[model samples]
Each structure stands twice: as structure tokens, then as C-alpha cells.
Target: MSTAWAGGTDAILERMEQMTSLFVEETRKSMYKGESATHCEECGEEIPESRRLAIPCKYCVDCQTALEKGSK
Candidate 1:
């Protein structure tokens, strides 16, 4: 009934929505944990004191930053 997606924009938007949902879920999971020194659960890197003080359980600021960039 429509031809809007003939250019691939629909596919791109669908993928973006999926990725956004996944990002939101993971972020909620991390932020809802306890108030302990956040350590990168994936890489064992020590999250900075500033980050923990602000977020409560960030764990590995660098790794998280990299992951966020990769997602973009």
C-alpha cells in the first residue's frame, strides 16, 4: 500500500529502534544495581571514582564509553 521503504529508510529505522531498545534495557539494568564501586564486569577495569560517585555502579568508564561509541 506504500512505497516509503523502497529507499531502505524503513530498514534503517527498524534497526535503530531495535538498537535503542537494547541500549535502554542494558542501561536500566546497570543503573538499578547496588551502590558499589563499579567495575567493568566485561573487562575487569576499575571505573573512575567520579563516575561511581555520580552513577553508583558504572564499572569501567573507558570500556563503557568505547561501547557507546561503537554503538553509534
Candidate 2:
């Protein structure tokens, strides 16, 4: 009975380790600002009025739109 409990504990510990590793990987990803899409991230584009509101960003409107569509 003790051995069975130990085995289950080991499995749980292993899964926890995997989850922790995955979390670290994701954290690393978010560390970066954004992806490349030719357009500025902040204003959406050099032309759009929305760009003035966004500020300090990169990707443009068309690129963001394509990204959203691709993800789906």
C-alpha cells in the first residue's frame, strides 16, 4: 500500500515538474515585446488615427488582422 502511494506521488511530482517547465517557457516568450509584421505596433500603422492612440507599439492593422485570422 505504501509503495502504491509512493508511485502516485512520483507521478504527481513528475507532472508538476513538466507544468513548471512549460510555465517557464511561456514566461520567456512573453518577455519579448512583439512579433515582426512590417507595420508599427503602437499606432497600427503610420496612417491610421488609431495609431496615435496606441503609441509605442509595432504591428499594423492589416498584420494584426491576418495574425488573428491565422490563429483561428
Candidate 3:
């Protein structure tokens, strides 16, 4: 009984839900594990507490930015 437009909308919504679930799962997998590092792995500078909590990874802001830029 659903119209074509309604069916299309339902399909779009279902795809969006699937995409959201996949994104969440991948994010969880990529998230840093173990205790957060206090110093930048590259420069040995003390990582700010805010940055540590925000990223919980090895690199400090400067190093991380440089690494990202280099990858591009």
C-alpha cells in the first residue's frame, strides 16, 4: 500500500541506520588502547591533559598535525 516515494524514503532511512552502525563499530575499533601517553612520542614534550583526554593517543598536537600533513 506504500507509495513509491514512501518506499524510497524508508530505504534511505534503513541505509542511513546501517551506515551509522558501521561508523560506530569502526570508531570503537580505531580508538586508542591502554593508558594515555603523557609525552609526545616524536618530540618528548609533555602532552597537555586536555589533549590526552581528547585523543588518548601517542602523539602531541604539533607532532600529530605534522604527521597528518605529511600523509596528505
Best by lDDT: 3
> Candidate 1, TM-score vs. the true structure?
0.42
Candidate 3 residue-wise lDDT, 1-72, digit = tens: 757676599789999999999998888667666767999888999999998887677878888899879962
Tens-place lDDT per residue, model 1, 1-72, is: 568668788789999999999999998877757785657776888877887777766547666777768952
- Give per-model TM-scores: 0.42, 0.40, 0.53
Off by over 4 Å in 2: 1-4, 35-72
lDDT assessment of candidate 1: 0.75
Tell me model 2's lDDT, rounded to 2 decimals.
0.61
The best-first sequence of candidates by TM-score reads 3, 1, 2
**Candidate 2 TM-score, C-alpha based:** 0.40
lDDT for 70 (candidate 1): 90
For TM-score, the strongest prediction is 3
Q: Considering only N, C-alpha and C atoms within 3 Å, which residue pairs clash in candidate 3?
A: none
Where is model 1 more than 4 Å wrong at Cα? 1-31
Model 3 weakest lDDT span, ten residues long = 27-36
